[model samples]
Target: MRYHVLCGIVVSGLLFGSAHPAFAAGPVRLPSAATVSSGAAAAASVPQQLVKITDVTNIRQTPSLDAPVVKKAQPGQTYAIVETVAGPGGDWHKVVLGEDKTAYVASWVVETAENKPGKSSTGQEKPSTGGKQPEPSRTILNIIDVTNVRAEPDLESAVVAKAQPGQTYTATGTEGAWYKVSMANGKTAYIASWVVTATTLSGSAGQSAGQSAGGQVFIYHTHNRESWKNVAGSKSGSSVDDAKTNITLVGQELGRVLQQKGVPAITANDDIAGRLVLKNLSFTQSYSESRKTILEAKNTNPALSYLFDIHRDADVPRSQTTVTINGKAYARIMFVVGTGNPGYEDNAVFAETLKELLEKKYPGLSRGILVKSAHQGNGEYNQSLSPTSLLLEFGGVNNTLEENKRTAAAFADVFADYYASVQSKSK
Candidate 1:
């Protein structure tokens, strides 16, 4: 009953949630990354494109933290800007990494080198820029305070609109100390530079990815292509390349549930079987293929405390693996612990704790914890990286996605209870 009420709050919050002002403009969002991945090809009339790094930062291949790190940006260095994107994480500046390659940097780590005023030590425009700088990009800016939007670029111009803080607008161009904004009523207005912060709106910036601040949980699939009857819409073999209907969806569900419980988490969808095939590794080496992603996720988000390798069991009998609760069918969950690593006991304790938690909520929901040695294959399972990692088998090949989601939700609730207990003790 309480869970459903929380669900209502979360869902409603999502529905009415206004984005945090992408810093001083109004509470507005620029074009999302999926909509603006590419920019107009036409070159600007002498565009000033330089991004100066203000802090040591990482350059990523893509805007998301899930993407690979392409390079590290040293502090106080300036790089040529290629493009700017509004991604899930926030505004990412795509800059030149090499001749043709590009990498993304967080906007917070860098400032626009082109934004330097033409004034010298004295307060007059330098003669070099002809006293009139070129226009700025169509980037977005957040309004941080109540600012006046004038009809003309000059402050003496009539006040056409008043822009409150926490709103975002596209900067069509710029004049000395002023940004141009196009109003919805077809009027062009100029907002003073002092009350706004230049930034691109993105979902990632100042936002937890899934769960909570500094608390990330990793969810992945070792045998990602493993599917079920109607639920299994991938390949006919043990592994499928499709992410839509394979074991990846179950991992996604687990992540979603964790997020709903205020646990920040991300689900990885790497090609486990494809990597194994390329390396000429046996099917049994599937765990090896998944190890790289596990390490990479941790490398990108060091705060990740819990790691789950979610998979479907190969039990042939549907009746044996399925549990009926509240007239709804769900897949039973099992935790497998590997005892070959230095942190093996910690992993076992995590699995046992989760199993006990789930069983307390819904009796027989968990199949109990299973301990495996080196003889059981990949017994280490990279559990050494984090003592809180677990191998979760959710139902068998005969189970459907519906059943899997139900169990995933219940598991999320149990995990939330455990998380609360841990948080209390830490305090």
Candidate 2:
């Protein structure tokens, strides 16, 4: 009767066939948060000895490997510090992370300041380089054939404007290859420098527009532990904390799927991890605080096309919560759109296109599209990055962890096909 409370699950013969595999059924009791430890949290609390090396895919370990086999550490994974080094080829220190766990990350990967954890570093930050430069100014230059103006420094954030060649503008500043230029209408805009050559430079740097690089794909995982924080099951006594652990697992599984599928995307790294930039946040933070966080981060990477904010949902009955795939229980993939941002229409079209494409290929795995009109916090969910931006909910908290993992694999394949189709047609 606990299953009777499900409001979101749809019963269909396709979910469970006669086979009824044993793996389809989950543990007698759902997992508790105390059972799973976060590497990011562990890493931040490490002693002043070790360093974090990579931007993403940082692996924590048990003992330590000269070159260890990475078991976990997807986006927000971290390590604890034990010792420190002086220079570039510094000595690697080691330490324990979680219960019965230990690992050694490179000396460079970690920030020295974190050793003194919880202390405010804001006042000690360096002064601005731009302030020392001459007055903020630009000369009107012809626009390239195609370019984009992003809300942040990265390609994954929302896009605010697009620039076409022949559109003249004054160059204000440059962040890497992206140039912030004054628009004809006096509003500031950004364009990828590679796409346009300065009219003043003229024939010196002439390059065909056809040779321009295609738009990039930016991927984000909004791992919210607090979204599930207080949510308790109607039938099952599973608390929001339990639900959050499963959601974290979903984020990991989804990342594994993308890597397995070789999808070109950028996920956050622990060293760069901040509530708004790289580290995971609560659902409340993502809908509100992270909005500004992503906006600023996207400014650094400007060549984005598709932006995906991964999530997990709850608040459904046990029966409706279970998702079965290939006669095996798996989580369902849900594509969500918030009807609040300026790009809602475009986002809807993009979601529809993706759904149509996937349904024709994979079918039922995609549990249709869910549009949260009034309840979604900011209503944008950062979908304004592109018409193709969307929030993807893997499955409800009630679903088994394995189900979510398998669903990630399924979605990866579907995504590869979608990218291929787009490439073929663009040709």
Candidate 3:
């Protein structure tokens, strides 16, 4: 079977759930008319244009896919065009949703009406005023206590100010994962984007709190396209994969839950499978591909202390991979530690710690730890990259997304407790 072949050499088993934590949800309020009337009047001179969403896509806080999603837009939805901006993945249309509210949608996913398509008009729509056109203003709400405001975007830069929880600042621009804000002295300061929730003054509101800041933990997926049987479509096989709905969503949920618990985390959603196809590499080299992503994240944020490669187990019996606690169903979790690496023992201990924690908080949710040797599979599973790294199998392919997400929340709950305990001990 494809399942056995695809997942072979990776199974070394150890055994290791919670109520879903409440997530912050609501629409970001639109800016007052007085705050943006001047810019709106300037935009009036340009002919009104609109774009219809061609596919279901997220309207993000910023142009980047990594930016928090403000809301989901459906097909046939139309919005007034604001301006086009060049972003990370592709060109994006900044569309006005309300009198003073705007959000970004990928240009490729929307069809423009009464305008030339596929051509970027970034500078053409600027107000006729000799001065620069007004950029979207943003309010950064500090979610953590006592985060530093730096003179530059790098962490090594000198700290110029300090921000307290609930404090808000006006952001002028973004440089990487840092936000540049105007300080009281009329000079600008940089703040780590992960430490605060940002609401664009003219754009839609994002998560009111619990925004991802590159924290101590990094979550990613080596097999990002793995999907459940229900969502994977009519493909008749043990292995199911999808481009849009996949294990990456589980990683994202884990990151969000970690953030909500005050443990800052970043989740990587790189298409490793697609990369393999492009490079003409086989499935066995999945770890080799994901390692590049992990290295980039570690280089960008040296503070990353824990690395988790999330995945789903091959076709296993649904009964074996699920459990009910407090009347809610959740996918069971298993930790796989590779004994091929020199520091494999440390990874095993870390996995054990998490399993024990889960047993205490959400009993029967963890299947226990499994150890694999070099002969068993890849045997390394990239655990050598970090002593704290482990390959986490969230559930089997038969499990549902809702079950996997519940497992993520439960894991995040215990992980936050574990993180707090570790921090306390270090102090």
Candidate 4:
């Protein structure tokens, strides 16, 4: 149902040539003849607009006819609710479009619905009225080794509070490591920036995947399809359901990497086995609600210092789908951090650690951490359960299934190297 909502959304408002021969093929229906008048405006304060042509159009770089193109829109480009003055020469009214990407558009081709007019009101008197909005939710960070919440922006500042590797905290806003946050009380206070790791925000550039033990990794698309109902990518057919697969592969890889370094490590599936490697520990929904499937593997596994949830992105481009053995485009990886929970700082630290290690080994294959919106992707996805937890998106849907599968195997190898390194450090 939710995916359907995403599918229906038009990213931008642009129309080229007509898709169908005609615009109106059906008869128009009128509202009941006797309608009572309502005082409320027909449309809300938020903006709205529509596309003009029958087919999709591209959002261009400039407002003119010759502007460079950015992205294309599907039929019925949906614009915000607002008035658009006509663009130069063209019948198109210039407008901005899309939720994830706010590209601009022309209006001549699209038509605006008859907006119910709004009454005149004081425009300058609103922001001050809403006092102290509620504080946002917090997240816990697990798997970090050492961390401290400080008073000032710099590391030299006094330690206002201290947090362990797997400790939890309520994250608010940030300036470097200094966070302006609410105390356990109702009032807000400033905490040291270094005290907590900062998560990547939404729409930020992704980290590039590099070669460590694994140059590229992909999660099997069929894994999710075979397990869940219809959640796999219907369009791309490459999206995994959750992060458990990444964790399982990592665990197994760690065993082999440890053996290579003479550490005598053993690994098994944590969800299917139910071995009680760790008791009662679990991540929250922002991590994933369905991780209960992992219950089967956890029963049969060994205790681990970290837990990872691996996955991949969808609606990606085909150019990013190529994989080469040496000096070639294989697969890209994405790291995600959720800001809607208590351990945001801790989780950020863990993400940074993983990125640092993976970058050193893989070079450019690992993409940076993606700051997730609370509105989508498990909402913090499963990071809140432990400090060491992370949700990794391997590649977009367009990537070939085999490339993605080979990428996953490569990830397994990198995890092995990371495990050996961590063991040596603990010693």
Candidate 5:
């Protein structure tokens, strides 16, 4: 029996180091009486304390000894201290390099102003009003799907919280490239500066210094187990299915590419076929199981604006599903738009926009948009979730995984441009 392609898709840390010999020849400078007094006055006006370099040391990207040295600090050089992190070798001080930059220095090489001898009990020795005024706090806008909030301003530090896209946090200060943010739990955590944009929050108007746009894009697989001929090792038939090697990998690749292009995306890897078996449902009910997954994702993240149900086509010849672009083989893609939903026109237009973008960039890489009705497989494909929803078939069963991945990257390239254009218009 020639198995036809089912559109609804059945399927399926580092340590710290010690000072080096090169710095040993130089005379180490400790905080003098005048320096201590100046540091004390500076500390009173700033939210963070100041630390003086006690020895010639290297400032590192992280709190570990093996971390890359970002700068060389000489003795007597003073930096405002963001916080102290305990490393494997010893405690490391996170210090501010500039307005939005920070670095780490060994605790053994730096001395805090408060640690000086003859420190007053009531802190009366320091003049409070004469120091530089503190800068106004800014708001942090997370542009990624999820980012780790570390206990310290280092990647090796423990993750204390998770920041989500479209969410804003109060940025208290900055260390190197890390933002010291006040978390919801009344505790402060550090988020990498690369994943977020710091903006000044204007009073009452709720306006940020930068543009706050780009909603979350959700990608999931309905037929999660759909596999290719070479990877699944199937001897015959039109399609293959595997639990481990499947279409979900393509979805993940697409999500990764989107993230690299600055678009916030989340890829869902729920086992739809396995869930159906456990629920005693048939393969035809794959969309039903995947719908639950979509709804759950939507409930978890209301910022999700673009929804995608990724699948692999079957029963098509290898020649039809594969294409050569720039001397590299890539699995051709198809956009399947279901007309069963009330707002499917919007979905169709969305799919058409993507298809046009894809074809313009990589000609013959797209098989065009396939309009389907209720009679043609599961017509809705859970696209009613959003007007921008789409069902994408990223190659056929006859194609290889590598081809699918290449096509995923190509599609992400097109989609990212399209997404940016849309976001620009919305502004």
Candidate 6:
């Protein structure tokens, strides 16, 4: 259901291109609590904060573009912020439309006065309000790890949020090693101060995948339906649902590279997404369907140790899909590993090694390894079956299949070195 929400979202007065919103232009939405240091900065204001509209924008009833438009917001018009939400569609700012009515505008459409030290008042001012206690001195801290934002300072308390790696938060106060962080919606959450770094945020690089390659490798994709069109010198059509046309070609490309490098690699062209159709199951069942194929392969040949699941990313905008390395176009890759299973460390090391190898040779090719848990999309991905299993996202829907194939070639080159190193070690 959520992936469906991310397929495509168009909002008015966009900071990025009008065609499709850029990935960096919007908030990263995961199944469960992922991470965000700017949770407090994420929402609009709690008490009505004044703002001036910078563009002609639609006033929607809800945060998503899918919501009905209440009216058109005029430029230079002043309105008070009622609330703000970082929805899958993008950031929406709730504002007063009239004396008794309200609607939401995209965050990009307005200039918030809340950026300043104090609040702004309406021209029709009321009587003086009672004095209030001074807010505590706030300290901005950088999250050094994937730490949980708790309901209370104590660990036993419920997890209200997750401080994603490299995200910064404004802490109001502290109780021992825990610091109190304020959120945009006016709620307070706590994160372990020790888990956060005091100085700065982490950069765009990734960690080293430290491990030798093991056994023959298996290559597959759960989102096998991911495809591209019109870029490989084709005049018409986009992604094909079948393996021969879509991401499967990318997998085959990588496999060819691996085989050329003398490493045995197999590409399982099972239409994992199509299996869900046969079962009449939701799209989430894709992992389950692919897992069966992986197990069968492993059972038939134990040499299949390492696994790669390749698919295109739809969550990010298309402009971000292409990254030029040495003036050549290539699809960027994000390695996602689930922590709910037993082989997390091994998988992480494997993923990290692949990233390190790729970045070392290609540079900016890997988007760092993103860790997910049972709390997030949660299928074991059957990765637990092998220590070196990985789920790789290459580019997005906007990327042409040809661009993805180029990336696959680059990835295969780096992987060959990694596989050869492992083989040498095992021997």
Q: Rate the local accuracy (lDDT) of all candidates.
A: 0.63, 0.47, 0.67, 0.41, 0.68, 0.62
Better of 1 and 4 by TM-score: 1
Write down the worst ten-residue block by lDDT for model 4.
208-217
| TM per candidate | 0.52, 0.47, 0.56, 0.36, 0.58, 0.47
lDDT score of residue 60 within candidate 3: 71
Residue 90 in candidate 2 has what lDDT? 29
lDDT for position 176 in model 1: 57
lDDT of 4 by residue, 1-427 (tens): 0111231223222135322221212222222211111111112222223333334565554444445566554442233322233333333333333111233455444444421113111112223224765333232221112344445544455654433222234445655323564434334445432122222211121211111111111111112321111233232354344333333443334333333333322232324222222444333222232344333222212132344555446665756634465654556677788887578789888778778776776666677887776776445654564566666666665554445555555655666666666656655
Q: Write down the lDDT that model 1 would get.
A: 0.63
- Ranking, TM-score, top scorer first: 5, 3, 1, 6, 2, 4
Give one digit per residue, the lDDT tens place, for model 2 in 1-427: 0121231132111111111111121112222111112222222222232233233423323222223334333222223343332211223334334322445443333333232222222113233346565332223333323345665544455667554322344456765545576533456555543333332211222322111223334445555542342343323344344333435555545545554444434443211123545456543554565454345434533444567776667656546645555588766677888887776988888888878876676556677888877575557787776788888876676666667677767777777777766766766
Which sections of candidate 2 miss by over 4 Å? 1-214, 221-223, 226-239, 242-246, 269-285, 375-377
Cα RMSD for candidate 2? 18.9
- Indicate which candidate wins on TM-score: 5
Residue 24 CA error for candidate 5 (Å)? 19
Rank the models by lDDT, top first. Answer: 5, 3, 1, 6, 2, 4
